[model samples]
Target: MDRVKLITIPKIEDTRGNLAVIEKESIPFEIKRVYYLYDVPTGAYRGAHAHKEQSEFLIALSGSFEVVLDDGIETRRIMLNKPNIGLFIPTMMWRELDNFSSGSVCLVLASDTFDESDYIREYDKFKLFKST
Candidate 1:
């Protein structure tokens, strides 16, 4: 919803493999947690929630997928495919992942550890919370 920053991480290409690294302070926030979503069936969606404090960077590692971001009042869609690019989601922005390709892998980097209180899972509740 609010202006989120999307950064494209540079990929180091090699004869054997490619690598992309994220160091502390390299991004807007420090790295506190990491997670990935995989084995998601086609037409299935994920991540219909918003965070209170956590900032996230999402990457499509294997296949292409669409990330729908809503900032309560407005919405935007982002297409992710390359491993070197990542979407930086600011706090309080609602997000949803959809149009996942087969064998798609979505990786997420977080700025905070798991805290139940930071999550706002309901859209209406998130809208109300953001307005205040």
Candidate 2:
């Protein structure tokens, strides 16, 4: 609800396999850091936080997972199962990742390096911050 949307990463198909490509121009923000999630246990959760200034693009490199997005006033759930599609999350929106399938690989492209101060880990605090 907070302007979250999916991006289509151009892919080149062939008999051997398919290759999905993501360049600098594919995202709204310049990617400054990259990381991934893998081997997560079933029913385990990740990314229960919101950023104040940073944005992130998430891709399901393998298997599938669900992303829950909250904007203090509204919430939405999205499924990520395709390697050529991705989710873009803008600033100040609460996000949580769960419902991971076995062997799932989640790739994250970040707009900035890790910063402890930029994170809002509490839901109440995130709501208050959004209200202000």
lDDT of 1 by residue, 1-132 (tens): 546877878768899999887776557888889999999997899999999999999989999899999997888999999988889998989999999999999999999999999999999999899899
Q: Number of the top candidate by TM-score? A: 2
Task: Find the 10 residues in a row with the least total lDDT in model 2.
Answer: 1-10
- Flag regions of model 1 displaced more than 4 Å: none
Q: What TM-score should be assigned to candidate 1?
A: 0.93
Error of 2 at 38 (Å): 0.5
C-alpha lDDT values of all predictions: 0.90, 0.96
What TM-score, over all chains together, does every model reach? 0.93, 0.98
- Scored by lDDT, model 2 comes in at 0.96
Q: What root-mean-square deviation over C-alphas does model 1 reach?
A: 1.3
